[model samples]
Target: MANIRPYKISISESQIQDLKTRLSLSKFPDELDNAGWDMGAPLADIKRLTRHWESSYSWKTAEAELNSLPHFITDIQCDGFQPLAIHFVHIRSKVQNAIPLLWIHGWPGHFWEGVKIMKPLTEGDGVEHPAFDLVVPSLPNFAFSEGTKERGFALAQYAETLNKLMLKLGYNEYVTQGGDWGTHISRALAHLYPQTCKATHLSMDAANPPSFLANPVLTLQHMLTPYSKREREGQSRTEWFTKEGRGYNLEQSTKPQTLGYALVDSPVACLSWIYEKLHDWTDNYPWTDDEVCTWVSIYWFSVAGPAASTRIYYETHHTTRTPENPRAVPRDMLRAYSPGVKLGYSHFPMDLVVLPSTWVRTLGNVVFERDHEDGGHFAAWERPGELVKDLRDMFGKKGGAFGCVKGANGYSQ
Candidate 1:
């Protein structure tokens, strides 16, 4: 059993003062006239946000609101790595046999992303929509969790840590839900520990084009079928991301340390980097200054420091540079089929990478899929109700992944 202890968001007064001090002295960058969002996060918006962060945004109040949830810390050590003080929100359902659902978040996101759907997913009427025991973790090197000093703590290590955490918590078998890095991590979990990770519900998806040698039928189907309006739009969206929106990805993947100096040293540098994603990633979801501050604050004041979060991009990409590489098997297999775990996906039209149904089906035994007309990258945060509904429908008695976890049918006594 793991030695678990209760945890809280305890940013020191001095830390808060330092953050404010940085915000006060931030240097503003000039923007070209009529540049709009194409250039980046608007100068006016970042300036206003920086001012609000320095003045009106209360870290104490934000910390209290976050502390209201059940937070716990435990040491989870992966192979060849030192123990990480993993921070997670473990909320159990009243339903005795509720499904254990591990919600993994991606970059520019933390455990806070699951806050909106946590209670709703746990407090459901068991018969109508099965309840879940949610475990939302701050991945090693993010938020309040400790960072790893080793060179190669990639996806497999991440999957190992979470799997060990679940088993330590007495959940030998469980399902998963995630997007962004969450999607990749959950896929890693399924690929590596298929017997332990029974099923997965993903909000974001990435897949290689089906080849004649690998998926002849899928390729033929794709070739014959004309893309639907949504699929066409999704392709355009994907292209836009590939061409215009990938600068951050390239920098983070190839040379994170170069950018790390900026992230760790300047509060405004961190804010502008992430705030741009908040604006562009979502489908016109109006962001409050407070909301933006809290999101960025989690990164700014993260236990490992904001710079640690960016290394995941570098490590994962470098370790899995080639498909033949065995060190990171999930990188290749994530897009390939997984026979052991059941799969479900929620496709938000405006998500970063959206593909036609055939291309996605190559990943696994996809038992459920829902295509949303709206919403974007942050499915849980932006459209909690819809994301929750999709979960229920996917895991309900009539749905595909029902009773996947042994002895936990996601029902009340």
Candidate 2:
């Protein structure tokens, strides 16, 4: 059994002072006369955020709030990789039979992403909705978790780490919820361990248009079914992301090390890089300066450093590609059918990749799906209420995935 020890976040005073010092020394870049978001994070917004981050934002307060959660660390050794100290928040519901849920976060996101939905999902009247015992982890190379020095730590390695963590916690079977990199990782988990990973829920799933050769039934359904107004609008959003917003993906996937220098050396550069995504990705979600700073602070002071997070993009894309290897980049396989593990999707219109209903249905045994008109990529943060409701509905008594996990129906006795 892996030794699980309690953990607490404690960023040194020197690190705090150094961040402020770097912010003070940051050089401002000039922007076009009217180049709003289209040109990138506006100079004015970055300047304002920089000033707030340096002058008024409080890391101590945020750290305190983060530390209040049930933090723990354990050494999880993935195959062929050194043991990494994995930081996670494990909150067991009072309901004895609550479903064990592993909520994952992707790049530019950490374990803290589950903050909003943490409490609500874990506490519910047995009769109305089911409760969940939530385990939100800082993936290796993100947040307080340690990074891997060796290469080839792709999707399979990530899935392996999380699976081991769940097993160590005595959760032999579990379900997953995630978006962004979370969606990909969860899909990988389902594909790799269909028996243990019983069900999965995703907010940002990616899938190609159904082809007659692969999914003739779904392809026929896709051909006959006219795209809904919302699906059409979602395609437009996806196009905008593919054309205008995918430069970061290309850079990070191919040349993360080059970009790492900027992220690690300059706090301002790191802020600007992530701030653009936060601004562009969400659906007009109001962001306070403190909130923005706290989010970026987690990255700025992450155990593996801000640059380490970008390597996931590179590794997932560049890792060994083989038909037999389950760990290989899950490009076509994740979209392909995987039996046993039930699936659910919570579609948000403004997310980076928005696919039509019939298109995503080919992923697997999709039992539940919900479409929302008013959210973006960060569904857990932007629309926590809706996301939580979807989980409850999916696992509730009337839902398709109810009682999927053996002896853990998410309902009270």
Candidate 3:
């Protein structure tokens, strides 16, 4: 597995030039008159982003910033075959009190999402705060990691890979925090490896109901609540996407070969697809045009586009994540008014998670629950300090229970 050929970014001046050329020449879609994002990625906004991407963006600068941290690549046996190598960033907190913390990003963002919190977390912001030896990994194929050849890349698939990553690095025990898909991964990890994965936390820890949560009247009440706004508006913008946002997913699960062509061939197309989501999903806080472009540019240079993200989507929808064997560890859940942004962006259909508490109860122990005054979908990227601070406090408490094997009662089964 160590011999799985290492791969780093190889974007050249010429490749950047060609990417710019394509962005400059690409034909855009016809819009409804006076239509803006109500149609999807307003033409004017897309043009503005395209112009900046073509003229002023520099991949080299971003590459250096990314390389400032330590990075490595290695393969973890997913099952029978030697799949694509996992690219990860490991930043160890020098503080003697540091707790082992592993952060995961799902779709939309890459390992880059967790970069902001690295220094403040590990460097010990204050005088005597314990540092966190961080293990931030790019989910297989989202950014720098290689694509998997497995049939589907679901939460279970990721859980398997992560288990190997921890053991490979001699981390028999660790703590995890995540938001979107990362949140799901955390749950799966806790359920699958309750012993090694000491505790789990999620910003979106809503569970699916037996079918009553979708009753017409109850669903209507959820829609009006502004909390489920994003999904509601998401469905309106992209008619097909609202049905679980499965357009790209279908291709990834069935014909990844065909989907890879468009993503690989047109760099601009990939950016347009992914960048729009960052804007559409988040509550649209702590992100500006420049930051948004930076995230998208990373993908362009890394060339870890449509294929990898699609695999995540394919793997998630196809995997067996839901089970009766309830999670045994404690969980901390934060609901950061994410639904409002999804609704305000456009009228897309949303799976409004009305009661995250009741939902999370099905999976595992939920110790802490707070509706964060700030942040939305990408909490780590949007509010790194707060997210890291919460993690530190939570992990600090977990450290207090270092030797205790069972979760404190009244948490979860």
RMSD of 1: 1.7
Q: Decide which is better by lDDT, 1 or 2.
A: 1
The per-model lDDT (C-alpha) reads 0.91, 0.91, 0.60
Q: Write the per-residue lDDT of candidate 3 for residues 97-126, one digit (tens) a residue.
A: 355667888766778888888888777632
Among these predictions, the greatest lDDT belongs to 1
Worst 10 residues of 3 by lDDT: 339-348
Give the local distance difference test score of model 1: 0.91
TM-score each candidate. Answer: 0.97, 0.98, 0.76
C-alpha lDDT of residue 375 in model 1: 97
How many angstroms is residue 111 displaced in model 2 relative to the true structure, after the best TM-score fit? 1.4
Model 2, residue 124: C-alpha shift (Å): 1.6
* Candidate 2 regions with alpha-carbon error over 4 angstroms: 323-326
In model 2, what lDDT does residue 265 have? 93
Q: How far off is residue 310 in model 1, in Å? A: 0.6
- What's model 1's TM-score? 0.97
